[model samples]
Target: MGCSHLVIQRDFAAFFLHFFYQSWMLYPENESTIVSWIWIGIGILFLTTAFIILLVTHYFEQIRKNKRKMIQLVRNAETECWESIHYLQERDRERLSEELHDNIISQLNIIRLNINTRNGKELNSDLKRSMQLVRELSHNLTPPDLNGIELSDFISDYLVQISKEVEVLYVNHTEQDILISGTIKLNLFRIVQELITNILKHAFATEITVLLRVSVKYLSLVVKDNGRGFPMEKYNKGIGMKNIQSRSRKINAVYKFKTKPEKGTRCIVFLTLNNTKI
Candidate 1:
């Protein structure tokens, strides 16, 4: 009877151990519900990621379109500014030329004729001298040299004459002679003349230097002054600067500046030049 009891006890112990092992390995409490929730969370994360990527791509496209629009607006504005400035300068030069030639010169000749007709005792020597000076001044104001001489030589001589009134130092660095068409030379000469006038009137500079250099690729000009320089941010958008910019563009050149208060100013221009002439 004691042996039979021992066998029954062993069988009961083995049955309980197998039941615990199966419960731990095959099934946890509420496993089906937990797995369904995990799959839903993963699907939400994937959708959020895709949406973010789409939004970023759309933002980049908008930025590129805005950049292109901005560039186009700038180009249009520049072109309009050029047209307006060119028109005004041409009109001004034409009117001034006419006034000098037709009105002032005619008046001077009339006075000279009257003096000649009056003859002897009525006219004083001082009066005749004054009339002569007037004629000379008029001629100087409307110089006839623009149409005749080569522009490079003309500019050199012109600068030399201006130097008597204000100090000017210049260098010419082109290897071969430059012979520009009349229209281009006239426009360039007027631009240079304006710059010189400004330097004399406002720069208050003791020294001024101009350099003209040419290479196969480009022709370059530099004008520098040791004087009080203006703020480019304020001055470059002004009417005078606009005029200069238009003229430079007409010549297919680039203009830039370097300046500082109490230090000095430098103006630079670069233009395409043929290899044969440089």
Candidate 2:
């Protein structure tokens, strides 16, 4: 009986040990599955973070590229402006030479001939005309006084003088007084003179309209004619057009030209007054 009891007790102890071993193996399998899921979650989070960083970096790169392009464009425009100014100066020198040779020198030669021929009667008249011509030319070259006179008054006087030949209509659309720098005023005067001269020389227009608009922020000048317009492609190649462009750049103003065949020509110059010398 004692031996049988001892064997039964040993069997029961073995059965308990086997059950505990099986439980330990089952627990390890379940823990391994949980660990694998946690590892996958960590990998997905890392990938998502990397993607967001890449997107942000790409956006900033695009912004930097655009900024560089804008800076380059501004530099190019400034260089072109300086080149235009140089060309204009050269053209003016040529004009001065021509004026001296054709007008002043020619007139002096005639006077010398008259004196050599002993034509005293006509000499006085010729001398007076030549002096008057010289005075007129000098006045046109010199800059006008803007201290006492307003810009509108100066332009009005100019228009009155030119009104005799062509029907000119002047319109000033500003309630308050307009003020501008002497340099700006002079350039503006020259631009207007050039435009009118161009119209007289080329445009067979019956009437011309000059409009001046002023505001707190900007000033605009519009010159339009009712005549046959020339081709824009050809006209842009002319010296007069180049002169206009150079003057506009000198003033740091915006220039626009509108024209079509038989539709007449319109030139508009816009100047911003904010933080500008004008």
Candidate 3:
């Protein structure tokens, strides 16, 4: 490398001297002064060209760096905003859970006891059904036990419970020991929840399926529904879909979807456990 650089410098110097000699020879009568001005002009042009190139390169680099930073900043802001929203939702759910457990459940029990004593069996049965609905609502807000639980198991149980409302089928090809960081797990779980919620809200289908598969390099989850699907271009570009995409991107996961009207909607989420740039 040193020898190559030395040779480059030598060649440049020889070219410079040759160019100067020729320019001076063209104006040999007053060659010295004219040659000086020509050399100065040549030098200025070289410096100006160098400066322009450097400015352009610097501007391009700055633009690239600013674009990257802006993207990162927007993503971070999105994450924080979602977190705050989740926190608020959880807070509201917690409050609702407490009200259900404390006020509504207690009042329903009292009503049940009062009716059991005063009214016939029909009234008591009605009270029991109302109490049951309250209990279901409470459970839906906050999971009973999640501490030290594997997310796969938690999700499995969740789907089974959801299956009671609408059919849910789980196809598992995962090795079962693929544990992830808590934050990653949380984000993924929320994504699953969001997809499931979307299906419940929109898909008037009889059955939905969630598939999990994992390999040494990647973990993938596929959620599909046998519903009256929407136009692929329409729904996939909707707000909910965009939100899912954003959350998936935060975890460096690849998100894809396939859908056909009157057919079904299928979403594939793939994540790498290691911090490998996508």
Full candidate order by TM-score, most accurate first: 2, 1, 3
Q: Which should have the higher lDDT, number 1 or number 2?
A: 2
lDDT of 1 by residue, 2-21 (tens): 34544654564465456545
User: Which regions in candidate 2 have their CA more than 4 angstroms from the true location?
Assistant: 1-142, 275-278
> Each candidate's TM vs. the true structure?
0.48, 0.51, 0.46
Candidate 2, run of 10 with poorest lDDT: 97-106
Predictions: Cα RMSD each: 19.6, 17.3, 14.8
lDDT of 3: 0.68
Q: Model 2, range 160-232, lDDT digits (tens) per residue?
A: 6456557899999854755676766656766776677666657778798999987767889999998888888
Compare candidates 1 and 3 on lDDT and give the better one. 3
Show where candidate 1 strays beyond 4 Å.
1-148, 275-278
**By lDDT, who's the top model here?**
2
Cα lDDT computed for each candidate against the true fold: 0.64, 0.71, 0.68
